[model samples]
Target: MKRRSVLFSITFRSAVSSDGCKQSFIIRYTSAGRKKSEPSTPIHVTRKDSGELGDHLGNGHLGQSVHLPKRGSSNSNLGEDIDIPLNNPRTSSEPPRLKFTTTSRPLVTKILSSSDRHPSANCPNRVGAYTFGPGEDYLFSEDKVYIVKNDRIISSDSISKMFPSGPRHVNAAVYDQEREILVVIEEKSVYGYKRKGSDYKLESVYPKELPSSIAFTPNAAIRWHDKHQMLLSNGGMFALYDEYWNKSLMTGRSSSYFKNLPDRVRGISEWKNGKANIYTQSLVFIYDVARDNVAGEGVSVPDFLRC
Candidate 1:
């Protein structure tokens, strides 16, 4: 019995960069359940359209679509087509250096200031607002006093940057990754930015209370969970807000030594399988939102973790 089939579908995958060199390679497959690869080398095509190695296609080993360069091509310009390896076999025991290269388009960025000196136009001491961009791009924007900003976007392409504008400094800001919405807490109101194509639209604004001193650290206390829920704290009391930005989905107080000061939100998360956990003060509030009720009574936190 004999069967014929087209088994080749070639796709070029870029090599990762290290230091000043990139490792380009060609892949070979085998029936032994192993992948074989060799460094891609430039070839000066001969009249036969072959490389240093002979016509590597005699047995139809390479697919029919594989096209070799036509003759008269000089590989002297190989450096322009391939990245050279960084390590010199003769010396340099150090690790390979890194190089920056990306296959994607660039983002946008805005820099507000760069100084922390006395009475300068840049680098103010206070932070009024901060938020990340849509599409999970590594761009972040911040607002400050006098409406100054030093925005930045982390990206592989040097061009990936962002400049998201709105009201002045925000007390706190949270990004809803799933829905691509930005929720910002301000001195007197909460604002929501909905992602529409490359820009954000102010969809909702809930006027209520915002704490005067909600300094955003690496670990922000307020967060978005589920489809339309947010867990927030003043430094002591905790509450859940829905997407409307109009009313509290629910509110709860912390029974701890921190009751006198403003309540702070510690954490908020909901698993894909529907389990939810909200951490604040010394307790964890688990909720089953499908039922709109607490999953269980207040549970004690473990000592190993600091809420």
Candidate 2:
């Protein structure tokens, strides 16, 4: 099993000033389950010209103000002299400090704001959304926000988690309407439950698939249809399965390409025309299963797609 590497970036702009800096990184994985991370260039603090100093001055607490340079002395030449403000004790350091101002690419913004934010105490290393289950009757236990409604925990626990205390976030959930079952996918394993009296009963376990995300058809009562089926994409590939499970559809376009996609694929949504949409840091890829084509941009989409 060959490991792969992907690109990731983080932009930190001084809310104060404008020195203009950005940082990027690379993540590599090994077949032995070991991982290596490449650090990004450091970004210095900066102050924007638009009265940022005044804003910080007004607030007794100037958050992240270390990025700003002080005002220059009246006797110094504008270009030759450093702007070292004498009044502020905080800016007393005489050493030259490089500063930077950055804008988070819309894509990175989306990734950081992922919808999954809960971590089960037992599974602290998971990331994303998950369905947890079969707890004592009438007791619902989700990573966050749990409630029991109609004696069913599926709906209440099916929501996504954006932040988890552990290493990963729970990212996948499947609710069965026919049996009122809930399937959950965490970082390393999958669990399933079926309705039993007022509580759920443990059923079967799906084989572990490393670093994958999952989803089910929108309606529990109606399984995948010729119209549109629920799809799952780890951002590396996609799988489509029906109720019977007799036929499994798998597509991985440009195996080498998607295989090396970002480690953090934020969202996977099924689109009409047999295409699935995959989102990562500042990028949205449209994967056409029917035609085996892929197209997308590393930019923020307009409101239409968001709605």
Against the true structure, whose lDDT is highest? 1
**CA lDDT of every candidate:** 0.39, 0.36
Query: What TM-score does candidate 2 reach?
Result: 0.27
Give per-model TM-scores. 0.31, 0.27
The C-alpha RMSD in Å for every predicted model, in order, reads 28.4, 33.1
Clashes of 1: 23
The CA lDDT at 272 in model 2 is 50
lDDT per residue as tens, model 2, 1-307 = 5544332232322223334332333334344545567654454444343422344343444343322122332533322312223133344335468999887755534432222322321211212332222342111123542332222222333233321212222445445444455544454344455665655455554333432223332111112214222334544344443333423454333244333333334444424566554444334466565555556444332221221
The prediction achieving the highest TM-score against the true structure is 1
lDDT value, candidate 2, whole model: 0.36
| Per-residue accuracy of model 1 over 208-230 as CA lDDT, tens digit each | 45443322221232443334444
